[model samples]
Target: MRYNKEDLIEWIIRERQPGGQMFERFTERARKVIVQAQEEARKLNQNYIGTEHLLLGLI
Candidate 1:
């Protein structure tokens, strides 16, 4: 199966685990950073988010 950018982003945002709801408390800029991290992971064909991806997103 293939996941598009929007799908991946949504999955990341809607993660149904502990701290999932923490996303709701994030500032708009922080949320954008998460989205960008997901995008960076996708670009690298990675299925998981990592510090490097988050750093790239921040950049």
Candidate 2:
């Protein structure tokens, strides 16, 4: 399975277990991580954003 930006966003939201309208708060951090991951991949000249790239961003 491919882990794209949307998938990551959905995963984060799902994992948050947010209450009521609090889910929205997770969006910003999720987006930031996505953007940073993309940038890291770009800097490394990666053609696809894979799970390894996402893990790299986490570090």
Candidate 3:
């Protein structure tokens, strides 16, 4: 599988939908950290950015 910017953006949008699923507001730095996690997942040939990637990005 391959990861790309467009796909990642779509995933992020889906993850942030209404109804209290995952609609928490994020700061600019938080958004950047999410993007970085996505990049790291892609670099490692993974399709999704899991907890480990997010933690690594935040650290």
Global lDDT of each candidate: 0.82, 0.67, 0.74
Candidate 2, poorest ten consecutive residues by summed lDDT = 15-24
TM-score of 2: 0.49
Task: For each candidate, give its TM-score against the true structure.
Answer: 0.62, 0.49, 0.55
Model 3 regions lying over 4 Å from their true place: 1-24
* Winning model by lDDT: 1
Instruction: Please identify which of the two predictions, 2 or 3, would achieve the higher lDDT against the true structure.
Output: 3
Q: Assess candidate 1 and give its lDDT.
A: 0.82
Candidate 1: deviation at residue 37, Å? Answer: 0.4
The superposed Cα distance between candidate 2 and the true structure at residue 59, in angstroms, equals: 2.6
Better of 1 and 3 by lDDT: 1
Q: In what order do the candidates fall by lDDT, top score first?
A: 1, 3, 2
Model 1: ten consecutive residues of lowest lDDT: 13-22
Q: Write the per-residue lDDT of candidate 2 for residues 1-59, one digit (tens) a residue.
A: 76799988887777644232443565666656665677788899987768877787677
The model with the greater TM-score, 1 or 2, is 1
